[model samples]
Target: MPDTGRTMYARVVEHTCDDCVPVSYELCAAGGLMFIRWTDRTGGGKPVVRETERLISSRAREMWRDLLLGLVR
Candidate 1:
């Protein structure tokens, strides 16, 4: 795994098979959204994963709940 500047990304890595390429791994940064990756049945192919944005939280639950109720109406 390698460290990038702000965002964190992982490379697809293959093992045991000569055709597979070794991927570079990385971890998500602090307070950053995490990503996922996977492979298909094909012997050789690009990895698939999902993109995500940062998460936000509220300091008070009552404030958030009231906001949600207001929107629902």
Candidate 2:
């Protein structure tokens, strides 16, 4: 999450359970591309944030749908 270029106005398209686990995932869109963001809140310390490479909305949505269907992890 150190990337200063990350969009501050990113729109979250979908997300996993919130406040119910130590980790969460979000499908986001910004600047005409989509990507997956993951956060880990383990060890009761600073959370670790990461993201997948940005892709076209259609392709990213397909991957997001597959993730929801348990077709991929």
Candidate 3:
């Protein structure tokens, strides 16, 4: 990840499959936005990475609050 000049946190999850290619997801939060990345190797080729970002909104914050409150499962 490139330096964004802000404090950030990242979480990475990897998955392996018997019938499909392995894949990973990276989630990062920094500078008031959420960054999501997905990586995978298809057809035995080089790894592919796709990334996107979303602004943190009040609805998202409320959803997080509900998650913390055990209202979302």
Tell me the TM-score of each prediction against the true structure: 0.23, 0.82, 0.42
Of the two candidates 1 and 2, the one with more favorable lDDT, higher being better, is: 2
- The candidates, ranked best first by lDDT, are 2, 3, 1
Task: Give me the displacement of residue 49 in model 2, in angstroms.
Answer: 0.7
- Candidate 3 stretches greater than 4 Å from native: 1-21, 57-73
Worst 10 residues of 2 by lDDT: 1-10
| lDDT of prediction 2 | 0.85
Per-residue lDDT for 17-44 in model 3, tens only?
Answer: 4246476544445556655455666647
Residue 37 error for model 3, in Å?
0.7
- Which residue pairs clash in candidate 1? 1-25, 13-23
Expressed as tens digits, the lDDT of each residue in 1-73 for candidate 2 is 4434577788998999979999888999999999988888996898888888889999999988888888977
Candidate 2 clash pair list = none
Q: Against the unseen true structure, what C-alpha lDDT does each candidate score?
A: 0.31, 0.85, 0.49
